[model samples]
Target: MDAAARDAQGGLEWRVTVPEGATVKVEHEHGAVARAWAWLLACMVMVRSTVAGFAKRVWKIAVDDPRKAVHGLKVGLALALVSVVFYTRPLYDGVGGAAAIWAIMTVVVVFEYTVGGSVYKCFNRAVATASAGVLALGVHWVASKTGELEPVILSGSLFLLAAAATFSRFIPTVKARFDYGVTIFILTYSLVAVSGYRVDELAALAQQRLSTIAIGIFICLAVCVLICPVWAGQELHLLTTRNMEKLAAAVEGCVEDYFAEEPARPAQVKSDGYKCVLNSKASEDAQANLARWEPAHGQFGFRHPYSHYAKIGAAMRGCAYCVEALNSCVGAEVQAPEHVKRLLCDVCTRVGTQCARVLREASSSVATMVSSKTLDFAVADMNTAVHELQGEMRTLPSMLTVKLAETTSLMDTMPLFTVASLLVEISARIDGVIDAADALATLANFKQVDNDDDDKKRETEMKVHPLNESDTDDEASPENQITKV
Candidate 1:
């Protein structure tokens, strides 16, 4: 799920590149050495896990909580130690299989860094990885039994798997579908190795490589878990929070399209209702600000839990409802010929406004508190949280656009304004939090520097007068004092 990064369009997520670099190369190369490679790589890993560490470091930097970086680094180092001790044992002993495993581990760490969102975290990653490992093991067994890793067959299987993964989400639950899809891809890859396309030796070699891969996973898993202590979730939370803003921005783009188009009667449109509002496609003009939910990149959000993704998911759902309503009401009558019917503006005044208010409350809920409350709790304090009680709150402008669009569509007349003003309000609201966060982070940084400077100044004075002895005025008064510096 973390692999599902955002495409340039930013609508849905896509796969991210594996962060393979010097460390991964060196790890694999070291593993390949005749002997003592593990020790050598251990002394100095092939790769320094920079790419792997980038996301976390960036998150901390953004939140002005660099101190967390130290803890993260410590955890990473410990995981590395564990990996070196466990997975690299066979290689260190005689197999001299160090390089490939090291490379894979580095790759895994990089994947961890790049991954984002709750679906990835929905099921524990350890569980996912262990399951994937078992799957890989199983696939390898199948290959051994079948004596076939056919290119055509594997390719077809992969295609079907991808297609199925995407479409199957319509049934059962989204989380299960996503996890199953992930397992499919993972198992498919595992089967490739086990299918004996080449021979048993290759399978044997693959098995060894797989074991080494497991070592890297252990390190990555351990390291990933350790970051929470350092930043206290401040940094990672902000990163996802920014991603949420982007999602809101995406929602706004649709609303803007509604406004930018021709204005007409609010009531005489030809559509059925507000269902069209949920259209995932944004206008072609929105080049810069189009992609909404881009947070699905690598291990970016893996440090946190699923709650972050829930916000994004909520936003998406809100968008969906807005779209559905739009389909039903797009191009509807704004002014009644016989009587004054409630227009889109009224909905804006009520639902969207209410959502904004709820979102605002949600945003402010945390600025005053410092408890171990869940992120969902913080989200509940927002205006959109009105949906919590009613099953659907509409702080989003697109939803209004969708409804208005549907109304006008049905009536065969465009409204004076199909777009709602709430998008700007939502954007403003999100920006408000972002601005406050930036300011707070800056202030935090400044205070940290100030304190560090004060500590240093104190330290300098300590060096000049390091003695901890209690001062006594009675020690011969002025005669006891030394005049020398």
Candidate 2:
């Protein structure tokens, strides 16, 4: 009986231990499988998110400027045209397979967004390739006659020419206009010089390369100019005009913000307008450089005053700097008394308004390519306001000295004074902008504004908003009437 009970208990214990072990093993396997599935899901989600983000960015880029898409299409078209050389047996036989590759390479390197940029690159590539080929052939001939000294002559000539071309890039004019050409000169010369040592048919090789490259350049130029051509000169002109408008908005915003009854929120100030002007030097220089390469197009002549755009940009930037300073003053912690601000408010508003008017007129002149006869009147009005501002400034010291003697420190008044001074400086800089615009008009032969048309426009405006008796009296005022030249 005792032995039977012990065996029964042992069996039960064995059964319990085996099943428990098996359950634990099963659970472990299930956990691992779940974990593997979770990891895969996470990876799939990440990949999906990444792809969505990439697509969003690409869409944004395409939408923001459809020109980019057009440019891409143009490039694709050029590549396809050049690829025809490879597919055609007769053409391939003429240039050979290796030379045909040069055409494809030329399209890739020489195609640019603007017609000016494309022309610049194409001309540079063609000239550099031809010049290098001719010179390399000459060197090859000379080296061939030198017998054992052939290698030495070729190496020395390559070294000197490459060094000279590289050094020429440091020149300001060369660096600005012909830097790409110089770079191509170095590349072509080096390749030809080095290859000539091993290649027996050097002349034929050079000729094939030149012809193939010319074919590529012609295709690129034709595509760039003939299909939705973007002229750098027109772009530069528009950019200058837009910048002037931005500057005007900034000037007006700055003045209004400074004199507001309540201090302006940071978001209320239109700083981006002026900030753009500050950052546009690089774009201006690049566009101007490219514009020089563009031929006559639209209203622009072959010798259109693209350089004057630079001068206008410079003048606009000078005003922007002053506006920046005024902005700082407006946002300063030191506050001037309300009454003190009121003292200068009328004259300051006049000055700011007149300054902005002058900028707008100048901008309009550039945009329309029409010389404004009334621009002189606007400048004179701005000057008169500036004089009024100076008079107001002259009176501020005594008024502040008396009124603020017991109430506030002199440091508190400095912000207002600084703002006033900046406005004056900005007005002076605006004169520079006017002069630059005038210079552009003269050089570009901008159409003169017709006095009769102006008179008719004014008459139409008066008829639309007929002047009251008081308005007529104001217009008759000696201070209000401006002599039109």
Candidate 3:
């Protein structure tokens, strides 16, 4: 059987079915004119959607971040300038339309939001374009001398160059900054070489290409620097500070709620806490990489503290790990005795306060480029909080033994002491964060205060911080330590 279906738009599609040992006869036909019109209509629909999408995005950007509007304006002005220069009387006649397009493309390609980024791209494109032009000229000269062999030589050369350019993207350093340049290099080289074969004036074509590329690079750099420039470094600084604040909030929320009497939390709050931590890690890492291309401006010198920023990010992840463990222990699977709970609450309070202070101070320092010596005081407070928590932790085993002794069924009560052991592990991770923060402060060039010798003994206390309660529980089950207690 043969069947045809008509779409809502009156387009028809045919289907045919055949049984075993039977031949199915079907007709599938559309006039060339009708098919062409249908394709045109489809193209029109796609064009409409594309324009609508572009307009919607532009409106969204204008509303969300007005500073980005300057980028659009800059691009429009540069494009206008390119059109004027290339379409004008003397220049248009001098450099033909074919040659002018590469110059215009350079304007669209090289311009970037940051002055440093634009400048870097400008120089890279210029070098790649000029080298490609020269190499293309040499290849054209070789092919011309070969006469009938020209096609073979040119085709082989293009194949080799294209393969090489494609493979170059896999190189780590090239993939980072120059991958786009390599692609553009292959394109420019092919265009020049192929066009040179057809055009009588190859030298003039090469000269015009190099000149046009230079014009584009110069104009993009000038506009990026002279206009309302958005420095990548400044953006990175703000993002890093904001990420710190977000991390601080998440940590505080997790720690505070975990130690609360009612451990039950709204699902949204828990989800948001972990989401913020995870999102900040991804955002901070990307921004750090982009910031590497930024030049020194304002407070930063030629060499910025990218390494310190990375270390801070790593420390934040460590803090998030501890928070996750705390969250895991928050349920009825773990419980703290009244006295130990109070001590844990006190530690959480101190840790929260010091963390907030450190975040504020760090953010302020990043913004103002003024080193805060008070971070030394904050770190010291965190260290003390960690030490006091460790002291409480030392007493936990004995207290748990006593508590276990009172219970008739040790197996039923074992989960409660897991909270105590988890608290010890959390304290050690917190101490690590404090140490990392101190190191980060040093890297930030903060004025160092005299180290308090008293904390040196407290550092040794951290060694006992990891109390693997699982092993303890297992050993207790086998040896009947609960019975001994």
| Runs with alpha carbons beyond 4 Å of true place in candidate 2 | 1-39, 196-200, 401-411, 453-485
**Residue pairs of candidate 3 with colliding backbone atoms:** none
Q: Which lDDT tens digits does candidate 3 get at residues 317-367?
A: 676676666566555544655444564466555555455556656666666
Task: Residues 148-248, candidate 1: write the lDDT tens digits.
Answer: 55544445555665566556556555543254435544554545533645455544555555455555555554555444432223433443333333343
Q: How does candidate 3 score on lDDT?
A: 0.64
Task: In angstroms, give how far residue 280 of model 2 lies from its true place.
Answer: 1.0
Point out where model 3 deviates above 4 Å. Answer: 1-64, 196-200, 262-264, 267-274, 280-286, 328-343, 400-485
Winner on TM-score between 1 and 3 is 3
The number of the candidate with the highest lDDT is: 2
Query: Poorest 10 consecutive residues of model 1 by lDDT?
Result: 284-293
RMSD of each: 27.4, 5.7, 14.1
Best candidate (score: TM-score)? 2
Deviation of model 3 at 329, angstroms? 4.3
Better of 2 and 3 by TM-score: 2
lDDT winner between candidates 2 and 3:
2
TM-scores of the models, in the order given: 0.32, 0.86, 0.70
Candidates' C-alpha lDDT: 0.39, 0.83, 0.64
Show how many residue pairs clash in every candidate, following the order shown: 92, 0, 0
